[model samples]
Target: MQFTAKFNALAVAVVAAMVSQVAASPAPVASVVSTDEFLKWLDTTDADITYIGKPINGSVPRAAQDVMVTYCNKRTQNVCGGTCTVYNGPAACLAAGGTACLSATANVGFCDRGGCGGSCNQLSTCGTHLDNGFCFTPGTASIIVPPS
Candidate 1:
């Protein structure tokens, strides 16, 4: 009987210790930003991508751009005479419709053909480049809401 009583007391103590330890543990912190907030900040839906080429200011969201250039190490290559800001990582990349460490981004430029004046293009491709005497200009970044 004494042994049973001690065993029961020991069991209770163990349970109590576990409960106390759990209670003392820190609350779980959010490791990643919320999806809704991320989308909002990204200013685009999963369907479409924001192409922020360089004008030193362009289509990418201010916050997302900051994160990309700062946290994601986006760089300029003059991929189109206009600077193409490429970033890979985190929610921003996914939000930008890019995958595998790259966001969906394209180059920015205009057709420099004597007859194609003002014929603009904003993709990774252009028949004209800086060497072709065509200048680059980034397009506006737009915000989008996903369909229900």
Candidate 2:
């Protein structure tokens, strides 16, 4: 009985130590920003933005209708710059040609092939995170849009 009690006390202490360690750890940062926030950043950035599929006119609110994804060919000081294409729709496979950086309002998958057939990685697991929630996705051939 004494041995069992001692083992139980040790186990409780171990569990308490683990819980304390977890509580002391910092919370993970969210890789994807909100649609409104991403659009606001796009407005302020100097990167030339082009719309793919249907153009976002003043008649429609972009966030309500479409998932916006922006891909660029340059990365300067953690910023996605150069000529950037903003794909504004729920496309199964977005051909991100020669993309060096990417950002999206929603979490998507970046693939190595044009048709999203090759090895893919989630935007949330971005190896190199850039400024304004962009990911340094060099050689990204396509982006797989998640269904709404």
Candidate 3:
């Protein structure tokens, strides 16, 4: 019957429209939490935390170009644990001592020397990704923070 044929055509058109919409949607991007939230998280962690740059306070708004990096002294299984240093500030070479692993809100570079003047690797190209966005970066003695 013509009614059945028309109904089938309508269904096909609806499905086509849905498919197009889905295909046009943009891919999801990684999200970074606010400074306040990050501070709250830092408080909850058991690892010893040290700050290297700008002071962190609830009333102070984090710089837009700053990146939060947390480097740990140990990695067990796929976790970055032990004494950790939390760096929250602008782009600069960070002296990270005994850092075996690290995590960051944005991509950064890790180096083997104290001044970031040796072999370097980007976090985006991490070979050993640990739990919760942490990467295994053994022998890292410094970090290069790129401007955001």
Report the candidate with higher TM-score, 2 versus 3: 2
What lDDT does candidate 2 reach at residue 111? 90
C-alpha local distance difference test of each model: 0.31, 0.83, 0.81
Candidate 2 lDDT tens digits, 4-67: 9999999999999999998896753457777666778777988888888767554467655467
Please, what are the lDDT tens digits per residue for candidate 1 over residues 40-126? 434432223334423223434454323231111121352221223333223322122111112222122223222223343332342
Q: Candidate 3 has which clashing residue pairs, if any?
A: none
Q: Candidate 3: lDDT over CA atoms?
A: 0.81
Question: Which candidate tops lDDT?
Answer: 2
Tell me the spans in candidate 3 whose CA falls farther than 4 Å from its real position: 1-40, 58-60
Winning candidate number (TM-score)? 2
Off by over 4 Å in 1: 27-95, 101-148
Tell me which of candidates 1 and 3 scores higher on lDDT: 3
Per-candidate clashes come to 2, 0, 0
